[model samples]
Target: MASNRPAPEAPYVPNDPDFGGYDEQTWEEWNPTEESVRPVRGRHRVHKKGGGGLARSSTVLGVGVIAAVGAGGIATAQDGKPPVSISLPDLGAVADSLPEAKSLPGVGALISDDSAGSPADAVTAAAPLTAAGVSSADAEQGTTDAGEALRARIMRQAENQQHQADDAVRTAAEEAAVKKAAEEATAQQKAAEQKAEAKAAAKKKKEEEARKAKAEAERLAKLAKSFAIPTSSYTLTSHFGDAGSMWSSGHHTGLDFAAPTGTPLKAVHTGTVKEAGWAGAYGYRTVLELEDGTEIWYCHQSSMNVSAGQKVSTGDVIGRVGATGNVTGPHLHMEVHTSGGANIDPLAWLQGKGLNP
Candidate 1:
């Protein structure tokens, strides 16, 4: 693993050619004894609180034993040889055999002056380690021995970032769902409003049409009260504008009402008699002129009841139906003329006064 540690300083060298200037106070001389270096059943040692009084020399001997065991195990594995017994070499006599602290392969940082201390000193420290490499943000959570604390901080940071990402995704999804719901609600409201408007419009049109129909019915009722059909119990034989070779004119110019010879012909409306006796093919005819100067002519009559200069009211008998001059059967030939003397269909004129036939 990569570690945040500086290089070590040179090991102490003595002025004497064979041995260094070892001070009794600065450096403690440690020797490996058989009892101190005895192997436990397991790889670990569990010390009791007070009576476990292992000496510092014993701790050093344990480290040396571990190193020797590791080296021996490797050599045995490589040579396909049987496992060899681990034995502590004499450090005082074979001191030159030790590798330089700076040149030690992987443990160079452990013995460095800038590091915490030697392995034994570090393990024996009283206080828990501080969060050295951890940031203040992570350290605020808690502290432990160096490696564990750093590992915990890294795990917490990753979890926190993951939580933040999950929160962002959830927030975006919620916002989108809300927006979609609002849009759908708005569209529904618009559709409902349009439906209401269309319904109102259709209702208004229906009401207007009903009102116009009622007014027209009232007008027709009033016309019916003031006018009358010229004759009753008659079948309509022919309409005006019928084309044939039956008369002087190429087209018939009168509305023919076929009835019995003595069917009474009434005045169509309140009018003055303009001409009563016809001299030609109109036979016994009577002409009535309304106050508006529109003329109504009743021809092909058996006899006339009203004379010239006489006033007549609606439904008054004016003549009798007959088969007279130029007539094939007993009928009343009725003609209408506008105030401007333009000939018009009598049936249409009757309809204008609210008559159906």
Candidate 2:
């Protein structure tokens, strides 16, 4: 009975004879055909539906997930929050077929196989940094930038304060100027008022004086009508109160009118002749008394025309001029006496009667 299968070569062993280690056997050579053999379990290669493409895609996806987790850890650490717990589904079978993490392109620097390696360090190494070791975005907002902003704010505030102070100063100056102007205006007004008042008072005083002068002139004009001159063609020689050795008195108490002898003497005003003759040094004198008791004495007369107790009118011939008693030349000595027997200047009395002798 011959079987159509090839015999396997036996291995030589140094053992006892029951295991047939010393037997000499013959092997037959045979080649197997497809029809003669059946497929054995796990002996031949079997092709899957898609190939290794799905596995490669899944590996790339896993790498991207690891990178995303690392980025999240860095962000969390920078934010100063607690570390987040991350759970991943087991992909043991896929991990076993994948290459080592360090051997992968662009991913080798991020993930580490060393147990002591820090995830933070690995993430920091992958991120781009500035000269100060911080990220570019973080460096842009660093302490220097903050300080510059603060300084700018302070400058703005100071400028505003200065402007406010200037405005206040200007306002105060304007107010003071306005007050000064008002005071000056008030002073000017008061001065003008005082000047006007003084002018009015002066004008009133002048007007009152002029009125009084007009009244006095009118009174004198009226009185001139009632008075008359005593004699005409006479020259005034001695006035009242003349000092001489020619009379009994040391001073002459009468006004002397020099004229030729026999020059007629007229009554100065309307009066009654009280006496027509003199007995002593006043030779050929005549005395006339008025209604007001004023007396007129005509002395050194050459002759008398009016008798005693005769009423005589103004301009009536009462006597004639002469040098009869104590006379150096022909002249009339006229004396006036008030009601109280006081002698007065005859010239002044004539002027009071509105007559200039």
Candidate 3:
């Protein structure tokens, strides 16, 4: 049989007579735990606000154990046998040792358990942490801190990569610019050289053309000095061939000019007087030869002024005209011959320059 008497109620307040004066400020200021107190092993003093006899009783209650002057201290009225030593487990130590909670994507739960595969189990079970183990606020704060740190790291890495890319682009642009400048400079140098060469060639060509023109002028002047005319004023008396009995020879071999005796005979061009004297049947004759082997003979001259081998110029008075050759009136005779002694017409040759005898 069980007794049916009701259990007695425990005392709701401390029974120590001296504990009545303890206040909330004293309790709040008291550091009871080893982690909170500065010296783990030492005598600590507690001050009393009033000098009542209860202060002496308080000192007796604090003997043989660590004590503090606060509402939660071990002080009681029942012979001050230190109030039943309550072994309250340390909540702060449990909190400090607890594993950090992880946040799972798409799963709204805090992973607090250190058991292997706990996150996966939590996801499948859809169970959250025990109500007292981890508060929702603490889990959220941890997740926010971790996420902010990760975002900061990612941003830093992205900025570094961007800087590297920009540096590479800048270097490549500089190199390209340098290469282009070099090529342009080389091209300019080559063009300058080519222009110089072209100028030099043009200058040389101009000099050669000038030299050729000078030589041609000198050649013409030399040609003009190699022949002489028979008389300055004359009329054609008997041509090289005329059907008449005017000469001893079968046919006339030279052109005859009818002019007054003592008419001034001029040299037609510049040459050495090869012969200048009287000749058989052709009195007072003068002969001149050009450098190119062409010969001129002036017959029927009244007198001679140039000697053989004497140099004479064009328009020089070389002789006087007269009909001294084979029984003709006062006239002059002229003949032109090649180096092989072939005779040619002199009237046509002289008339080529608009000169009429």
Pick the TM-score winner.
1
Which run of 10 residues does model 1 get worst, by summed lDDT? Answer: 1-10
Q: Across residues 1-357, which tens digit of lDDT does each residue of candidate 1 receive?
A: 211122122346456333455422222222334545443322222232234433224444556556565545444433344554545533332233444343333333434344345664443333332433444445456653467677886798999999999999999999999999999999999999999999999999999999998888889889888889999999998998999999788999989999999999999899999999975898988999999999999998899988999999999999999978898899999999989989999898898788887
Q: Give stretches of model 1 more than 4 Å off.
A: 1-131, 134-166
Candidate lDDT scores, in order, read 0.72, 0.69, 0.60
lDDT of 3 by residue, 105-171 (tens): 3232432333435555555334333322333444454533444545655787999999999999999
* C-alpha TM-score for every candidate: 0.56, 0.54, 0.36
**Count: clashes, candidate 2:** 0
TM-score, cand. 3? 0.36
Candidates ranked by lDDT, best first?
1, 2, 3
* TM-score (C-alpha, index-matched) for candidate 1: 0.56
Q: Give the worst 10-residue stretch by lDDT in candidate 3.
A: 39-48
Please state every model's RMSD to the true fold in angstroms: 17.7, 20.8, 16.5
